[model samples]
Target: MAFVPEEDTHRSSNSTYRAVGRADQEPLLGKQLTRLPPSLQRPEDRCHATYAIFFSLGIGGLLPWNFFVTAKEYWAFKLRNCSGPASRGYPEDSDILNYFESYLAIASTAPSVLCLVANFLLVNRVPVRVRVLASLIVTLSIFVVMSVLVKVDTSSWTRGFFTVTIICMAIVSGSATIFNSSIFGLTGSFPMRNAQALISGGAMGGTVSAVASLVDLAASSDVRDSALAFFLTAVVFLGLCMGLYLLLPRLEYARFYMRPVGPVRVFSGEEELPQDSPHSPLVASRPLGSHTPPLRPILKKTAGLGFCIAYLFFITALIFPAISTNIESLHKDSGSPWTTKFFVPLTTFLLFNFADLCGRQVTAWIQVPGPNSKVLPGLSLLRTGLVPLFILCNYQPRVHLTTVVFRSDVYPVLFTCLLGLSNGYLSTLALIYGPKIVPRELAEATGVVMSFYIYIGLMLGSACSALLEHLI
Candidate 1:
C-alpha cells in the first residue's frame, strides 16, 4: 500500500479518492493504516515530473491538428491551380483554395464525435495504455505520410491530392480524439492540478504550433519546405510523448494514484473516511471487466458542467479559423508584409492561441464560479454575441453580408483575444470540475463523457461554421 501524507488524506474526502471496494461492502473507516515498505510509500512529484509529463501529453493531443491547420501557406500552394494547368501562384478563382479552410474544418471535426463515442465505449474494455499508445502511433504514422507528400508535386492530380489530404485529416482527427480523451480520462485519477496541467498543455500546444507557423512563414521561402518542417516537428514531438507516457508509470506519485481501488461506496462528503483508514488515500481507478459503472448517474451528475464545456467550444469553433481566418486586414491595399502575409496568422492564430494559453494557465491559480454555478452557463451564452460580432468583421469577398461594422484591424485582434481567453478559462473549469462531481469509480468514465460533450460541440459547431460562411 502507498502512504499518503496526513494533509493529503484529509483532502481526499472532498475529492474522488476513496476506497474502491464493492458497493455492498461496509465502510472500513476504522481500519488501521498498515505500514508499508519505504519503497511502497507515496513519493513526491520530484520536480513536478508527473505534472510536466501530463502537460506534454496535453500538447501532443492537439499539436498535430494545430500544425495541420496553421500551415496555411502550404495548403494554399498545394491546392492552387490544382484542377487547371500547373500555375506559379494560386488563382483567386479556385474554389478549393478559396474554401480550403472550411473544407478542412469540416473534414477534421466531422469524424471526431464518432471517434469520441467509440473511445467512450472502449473506456472499460480497453486499457488506457493500449488506447493512448495505439492512437498516438496511428497519428504519428499519418504525419509521417504527410511529411513525405510535402515534396511531391500534385498539380496534375490536384483533386486526388485534396481527397487524400482530407482523408488524412479525418483519420488524424479520429486518432487525436481518442488519444486526447484517453489521456484526459487517465488524469481523472490524479489531482486537480494534473488535469489543469493537461488542459493548459493543450493551449500550449496551440501556441507552439502558431509560433511555428509564423517562424516557417518568415524563414522558409518554399511552401513545401515550410510544411515539411511542420510535419517533421510533429513527428519528433509525438515520439517524445510516447517516451514520456512510458515514463509515467515509473513515477511513484502516478503509481499511487493510478492504483486500482476496489468497489467502494461513492464519497458524498457527509461521511469522512477515517484518517487512518488504509484506503482513504487511494484515488479513483478504472475497474476492469463488467464492473464499469452505469453512465446514467455520471451523466446526471455532470450534466451542467458538461453543457458548459460543450457550448463553450461550440461557439469557439463556429467562428475560429473558419470565419476568423477569412477576415482580412483593412490595410490589405498597403502592400506591407504585416498587412498582407502576417495579419491573419498574427491576429487570428498566434494571438488567439497565446491568449488561450493564458486563460488555461490562470485556472492553475484561480477557479471561480464553481462547477454548479449558473454563472458558467451564462458566460457560455454571452459568447454567442461574439458570433455576430465576428460575422460583421472585414470578411473579404462577402456576397450576402456586405457591411463591415468593426472596420479597424484592432477589432478583430481584440475580438480574437477575448474569444480565446474566455474559451480556455471556462472550458478548463468545466473539464476539471467534471470528475470531481462524480463518484470515485465513475471518475474516468465521467472524464470520457465530458470529452464527448466537447467534441460533439466541436462537430456541431464545425458544421454550422460552413453554413455561416455561406451566409457571409
Candidate 2:
C-alpha cells in the first residue's frame, strides 16, 4: 500500500539523476513491468533517470528538417544555373519524391520533447501552477524565437556553423527545450480529470500553428526572407511569456505520481516545498507500505525501463519526414502535381490533427474517471487497437488502398487522418495511465514513453513515404 505525501509538492533537478518508472502498474493492461530490474528500482533514482530522457529527447528534436528539405528544393536552382548545360545530380525525381521525411523528422522530435516534458511535470511533485507556468513560458518562447529568427541570414548555415547564426539556431533549439519542458510539466502535473481542459488548449494551439504557417507563407516571396520576422516572433514569444506567467498561479505544487493518488493544491506566498529528505537534493518521502532506504542506482534504473523499445523507435522515426521532404524534391521537379511537398504534410498535419483531436476527445470521455471508478481499464484497450496496424502492415496497402479513392489517395488521406486521431487518443490515454498508477517518488519520472511512439511514427511515416516512391 503506497502512502500519500501530505505536503503534495514536486522535487527539483539541477543535475541528471536516475529515475526510471516503477515495475508495478495498474491491472487491465496485463502489461505491468515485473519487479524492476536491479539496475533501476528506487523511487528517487527513477525521477533522475527520466530527466535524462527528457533532455535527450529535446536534443534529438532540435535537428533541422527544413535544412534538408530546402536543400532538396534547391536541386532545381542548381540545375537551372548549372556550370554545364549537361547537368548531373542525383535523380531530380528521386530527391523530390522522398522529401517528406525531412519535414517529418524536423517536426516529430519537437512534439516528443513537448510530450515528454509535459508528462514529466504531470508525475512530478511540483505544483500544477508552476508546471502550467512553465508550459506557458515554453509556448511563448518558441513563438517568439521563431518570429525573431525570420530576419536572420543563413546563407552558409550548417550544423557545424549553427553558432554562426546562433540567434536563429538558438530559437530552433530553445523551442524544443521550452516546448518539451512545458508539456512534460503540464502532462505530469495535471490530473486525470483535467486532461481535456489541457487538450482543449492544445487544440487551440494547433489553430495558432495554422495561423503562423499561413502568415509565414504569405510573407515569403521569391526570396524566403523576412526582416523583422525573428523580431516579431521574439516579441510575440516574450509578450506571451509574460502573459503566461501572470495567468499561472504564483505558487503551487504537484503530488508525486509514483507515490499515490491524492488531491493537491498550493497558495501564492511560497518559496520552496518541504524537503522530501533533508539530505536528499530534492525532498522525497516513501509511500505507505514501502520498506527500504533509497539506493541511488536503484531509482535510476527503474526510470529507464518505461520506454524500453519506444525510445529507439523515436530516434529512428524522428528523421522520417525530413527524409520525405528530401524525397519530395524528386517528385516535384519531375512535375509531380504535388510540387512543394508541403501540401501532403500540411494536409496530413491538418487531417492528422483533426483525427488526433477526435481520438483525444474519445479517450477523455472514455477515461473521464468517475467518482465510483478508481482507475480506467482502457490502457490495454488502446494498446489492443494499435496491434492490427502494426501486425497487418504487409496487407495494409491492399486493404487500405483498395479503391480509387484510396489509390487516388483520397481514402488514404481520410484513413490516415483517422489513424492520426486514433493514435493521438491512444497516446493521450497511455500517458494518463503512466502517472495515475505510479507512487510518489516516481510520480514525475518521465521516461522514454512519449518519445517512443512519436519518433516511431516519424520513422515509419518516412519509411512508408520512401518505400512507396521506391515501389511506384
Candidate 3:
C-alpha cells in the first residue's frame, strides 16, 4: 500500500474524497495535487536523485570520525616523543600514544551521547533545517582548522596538542551526532528505502576512509601530508553535503514526502485549505511544541527494536577498531608491507566496512526476520559469540589471557567479515524498522530515540572495549 500522511488519517473518508473532487476543479489546486503525489500514488524519485542525496548525507555523517580514527600514523606522529626528543619515533612507553584509541573513543562517544540527549529534547523546539545545517557548518569548520594544524609542527607542544586534539574530537563528535540524528529523523517521514540509503551510506563512509588510508599509506611518506589531505577531503565533502541538503527541498519527490503532516480542515464548496492557511485547523489546534509526541509511548512501542539496535552496536564497538585493530598479523616477522603497514587497514577497517556495506545493501533486496519477529533479537544475541572470537585472535602485547587460539591470519579475516556483514545487515534492519512500528506522527522522534539507542550502545561499548583491551 502507498504511504499516506498522518494528517489524512484523522479525516473521515467522505470528506477526503470530497476535498479531492473539489480540488480537481481548480487549476492551482490541480497543479498542486499533481505536484504533490496522491496519497495512493507515490512520486517518482526522479533519477534517484533524492536517494543519492540521502546516501551522500549518510556518507557525510560518519566520514569525519572515519577519517580521524583511520589516520593512525598521523596520531602516532603527533603524540610521539612528547617527553623525549622530536626526532624519536612514537615512544612505546608513552601512555598517550598507547591508549589514544581508547581516549578518542571516550572523547568522541561521551559528547555524542550528551549531544544526542540535547538533540532529542530540541527536536520540535528547533527546526530540522537549523540543526542539520548548523551541525554541518560546525563540523566543516573543525575539519578546516584541523587541516591547517597538520602542517604546523607541534613537536615541542605535544601535550597541548594532544589536549586540543581531544577537545576538537569532542566538539566534532557532538556536531556529527546532531547532524546524523537530524538527518535520520528527517528520513522517518519518507519511505523506508531512504532510511536504508542513509544507513548504507554510513557503511560506505567507513569503506571510503579505509581505502583512503590504504592509498595514503602507499603514496605518501609523511604522516602530516597524508593527514592534511585527509582533513581537506572531509572539508570538501562537508561543503558538498551543505549544498546537497540545500538542494533537497527543490526536488519534487523530497518536497512531497518532507511536507509537514498535520490535521486537515474541510471547507464548504472550496478546495481544502493548505496547512499554513489562516483558517486551517493546525493553526489553532495547539502550540507548536505540543505537537511533539510524548517520549514514553514511542519508547514503549519500539523498546524491543531499540534493544536489538543498542546491543548490535554494543557488541560491534566492543570488538571493532579497539580489539580488532590491535590484532597483529600472524606473520609480522616477514617484513613485507602486507604485514607491516597494510594488515590492520586491510583486514580490520577495509574488510569490515566493505562487508558492513554489503550487509546494509542486502536489506534493500531482502529484509528477513521482520521487525516484530522474535528472530531479530535472537540474532542480535547470537552476535555475542563474535566477542570471544575477536578476543581470541592474535591481539598483541597481552599481559593476561595471552593464549591466541586462532593464530592464523585467516581467522581474523573471516571473523572480521562476519562481524561487519552481520553488524551491517542487522543494525540496518533495526533502524529502518523502528520508525515503521510507530505512528507516523512520531516517526521523527522515534528516529531520534533510535539514534539515542545507537550512541548509548556506542558509549557503553567504548567503555567496555577499554576494559577488554586491558584484560587481553
Best TM-score among the predictions, by candidate number: 1
Per-residue CA lDDT of candidate 3, range 1-472, in tens? Answer: 1122324422211111112233223211111111222454455788989989999999999999999989888998888742356635545427787778888888889999999888888887799999999999999999999998898878777878889899999999999999999999889877667888999999999999999999999999987888998999999999999999999999987886777765422112233445334223211233234634467656876799999999999999898778898899989999999998999999999999999999999877566666666788999999999999988889987889979999899999999999999999999988987775444456678889999999989989999998888888
Give the lDDT ranking, best first: 1, 3, 2
Model 2 stretches with alpha carbons more than 4 Å out: 1-100, 103-183, 186-189, 199-207, 214-235, 251-342, 368-406, 446-472
- lDDT at 122, model 3: 89
Q: TM-score, each model?
A: 0.87, 0.49, 0.86
lDDT of each: 0.81, 0.36, 0.81
Candidate 1 error regions (>4 Å)? 1-10, 13-42, 82-93, 264-293
The RMSD of every model to the true structure, in order and in angstroms, is: 6.8, 13.0, 8.8
Which residue pairs does candidate 3 place in steric collision?
A: none
The collision pairs in model 1 are 20-262, 20-263, 20-264, 21-262, 21-263, 21-264, 22-263
Weakest 10 consecutive residues, lDDT, candidate 1?
Answer: 26-35
